[model samples]
Target: MKKISSNRKKNHLAWTIALVMAAPFACASDVNFSGFLSVGGGMLDDEDAVAYGGYDEEDLTFDRNLLGLQVSGQINEKVTATAQLIARSNNDYEVDAEWAYLSWQANDFVKVRAGRLRTPFYMYSDFLDVGYSYAWITPPQEVYYLPFNNVDGVDVYLTGTLGIFDTSLQAYFGSFTDDLVLSGAPADAETRNQIGLSGTLGKDWWTLRAAYHQADLTIDVTGIPISQTATLGSFVNTLRTFGFNSNADRVLVEEDDVTFAEVGINIDTGRFVAAAEHVEFDPGDAILSKNIREYVMVGVRAGDWLIHLTAAKAKDEATHPETGIPVGQPLPVVGSTNFLIGTLQAIANSQAIERDVLTLGTRWDVTTGTAIKFQIDDIDSPDSVLVDGTVVSGQQKVFSVAVQTVF
Candidate 1:
């Protein structure tokens, strides 16, 4: 079934690419074409460590590489249509539709966009895949690793000058459904009643941004349901019999409200660049715990090269609730349900993380619209799992190199 879906995606992408290639001849001067590409690879020092996004100890898989094409056409004096198709190495070479929208220029200060749009959650969320536009080989994964990326809906944007400061505001309403990795397994997920607002204020050499978004999130946990295993099932049944309904529900995932908030600042003064951002995720009353992530980066430019340092961290905001089951206690029928309880508790605690990473990198512009970058990361994850779910204590080192280009 997965293979079939992949084939369909490929066929659709082929047709889209053909149309885009022929658009210039068909529409004469009304259509424009552009694209971006990134070829990258990385490796970890520890061979036992689960690969980071497909990179292994000594293998360079280019799984992080991607190519994207964007086509836009002017339909009339007040409206335009834009679409972007991207093919990623991680998706088995299947091209996916990243953006397809119709934009309307309502006035000089206001505009509207309707269709599939990028979710405005962070400072760099909109242009995440365009590596040539950013200093890092990739954005901080601790903050950018959210499962949901886009929404299908409409948004209104307002931009103008406020005194000496240039200001912009955007409001959007949308919904999204996608497949996500949950607890090391694939699961179907959906976000309903998704709404968001973001604003930016800038003057001279610095800019400040803030955004808020919320939605009702639901995920199908049938693959690893809480009551499917014999031990877990018996434990949950015992808890319910003992009037621990809240505890049981806390261990199960269901429909709940998820909220995200972010604030960031960016500075650029010709030769110096600095950026810092903080974000929070609140999964209210869900099995998932609340988390906070933040990062600070500073860099200096000399000729065609820019060198930067970054520090980032992710921490859990709440500890797992006590299940109130006594350890080493004997219970009727289920002798030692205590062990099962402890295992469940440990799983919950594993979801909480206290991790930090330090990185140093250099990006050299090789040409007008191309760059080559080299980076080294020192990661310290004492109580957290890596992106691939490999548990690592203390510190580990990873190195990466990439070339990015845009045309």
Candidate 2:
């Protein structure tokens, strides 16, 4: 897929803003327009930490700043149309369509929607980009860095009261295609046969939710199939020369099944708030690793100010090719091939990441619709390596401040 250039993205955003600004005039009635904005700047204590926070050493960048516009119109008594566009500083002020969907209220208990929609992958998936909706300056990155966020398809949602609890259920089917940032580089990625189910139950100030999603995934590494990597390709070819075609195929990166499961709970009273979520990813492929992510946040409100603490972690399980190459297996080239295999195994093992972050933040309500926040994060990733192949050691600190508001 061709990536959109920054210049083109800017032009697209301008055109989109013009169209949205004229929407009310064109519709004349029953059309509503609103927007949200977040302007932020931050710097990392260590230059090597840039990979961890997207911040440069001692340089404040407004990478987190963003603007979103939403337009919704009631098409009839039972139908409505909504569209949202967002421009982000990190993307060079690129505008992107976050959502464009048509919804129908079958009755008070059920609703259906079609077109592009947010994937219900986590507790805050639906409002991931809307910083004003959440107390934290940003969502926990450990669990929120999934490559795909939205899908193109349809969904059915049902909500009602169950005794003293308010309950909701949702099911969706969709496909997604995008250029994703992987290992600090852009990769062409696609997901098909995407299906998911989610449910939530809430009463009073507490809520619980769970979701399950599965899809067939394909990712092009270095603009080529993963099986074509120089290292992997050489290994596979060597096996093939030894009449091990099946073994070679076992190490290939063909279409693979991937699954994601998540569960979360939250307690939100007027003065106190607590939330935690756990998610697991099983990428059933030799080229991809399975991982688990979790986070917990607690906060207390004092007058117009809220203080919060969060801890989050992610662990990637090591994966090995199924080619049955033993540690002492004889190589075609005695010393060189042995070294090659050893290096490859070490690389695979290094992909296993055990990292954690601790954050302290405060949100001050400047007005009913606006908030200002400051946060500091302590990140630890001893086993993880940066894009430049440098191992990250000890702990790094990042400081950030932002103002978020909704119109």
Candidate 3:
């Protein structure tokens, strides 16, 4: 899926519409064009100096205003092609292609797709951008905050029945390049040689899912403030200049291996629904911190309204790499052994994330293909236990409402 990050405004409606209008000509088969929209506004009830989920106390923000258009066509009995375009207010309406791929049906239970594809790192990844398909105003942010979403590659899927259970399996290979925000700094990010495998099993009212994905990642942030005098990258170079090759290598994020593992469960019993997903991100030999994120949700249906409660938590441990240089040991220049150790530790521990959130929400299906939703979110963060941010630890709250429709 695509995101409207930072601030850039554009009128890409014409571009998006042109793609949809030309879908028929691109395929010999009948074309299907569908669209979805989420129009809404949200604001933080307090905490002027800080922001959460694009909401601030200064004013009402429509950052959640999002639009998506999907086009698909059956190329043949065994093949199909799909493309999706998305625009968002936070991105200033600059349109982006969220998905563009061709799929091949090999048999009754096997399928394959290749091209620019959504990364299936999570359970809801296939429809992450489709607001009308899911129950939450948004998926649990903690688990969904993957560094990147789309990759250019291929995936294979298999589905069948196993005794009393239905089963599905997927494996994919791809690479992605994009801009990322790491530790509040903009950086060029790349993930290469990605491989992922996932499986799901369902029996009656419950389903279980598990997945694993891994890649070599590199990040280049310009002029980060981790070092008061130089960027971390530059500091690493300086360490190399002093023949501290081993120390320099330990602090760099060049082609570092990273892995993600997930397990989730979902249950639906006519009037009740429950789901939970847990994920862990591990960065091996990388100075970046590691994270564990998870969320649990439960809801009940009464007439047209589905009321729910969700709790999410994310925690990370700062990586503190040993520099080999002992404290009080002599150094070749103005910096001491302890100074080198401190800088290495500082760079390693710079990226730390910790948050806990509780949410209460209601969704009303006013009519087919449309819905209205309202939600209240309370956030408690160890990082947000601020000193000068003008917000007390217990005062962080946000309220939001949205109307979503698919047509």
lDDT value for model 2? 0.77
TM-score of each: 0.87, 0.87, 0.89
Which tens-of-lDDT digit does each residue in 68-174 have in candidate 2?
Answer: 99988877778777888888887877677778777899999999998778999999999887888888888988888686788888999999999999999999998
Candidate 2 accuracy as TM-score: 0.87
List runs of model 1 lying over 4 Å from the truth. 1-29, 49-54, 225-243, 318-341, 383-394
Query: Each candidate's root-mean-square deviation in Å?
Result: 4.5, 4.1, 3.9
Clashing pairs in 1: none
On TM-score, the leading prediction is 3
TM-score-better candidate, 2 vs 3: 3
Taken over the whole model, the C-alpha lDDT of each candidate is 0.77, 0.77, 0.78
Candidate 3: segments with Cα more than 4 A from true spot: 1-27, 330-335, 383-395
Alpha-carbon shift of residue 96 in model 1 (angstroms): 0.6
**1-407 per-residue lDDT for model 1 (tens digits):** 01112334323433554455445436646888899999998888775653353455665445578899998887777877788788887786577777877789999999999877889998998898899998999988777767777887899999999999999999999887776655545667778899999999999999999999999888664454343354334555666775568766666556678899999999989799999999998987665668899999999999999999999898876535445656776766657656547656665666666678898999999999999999888878764466466675456778899999999
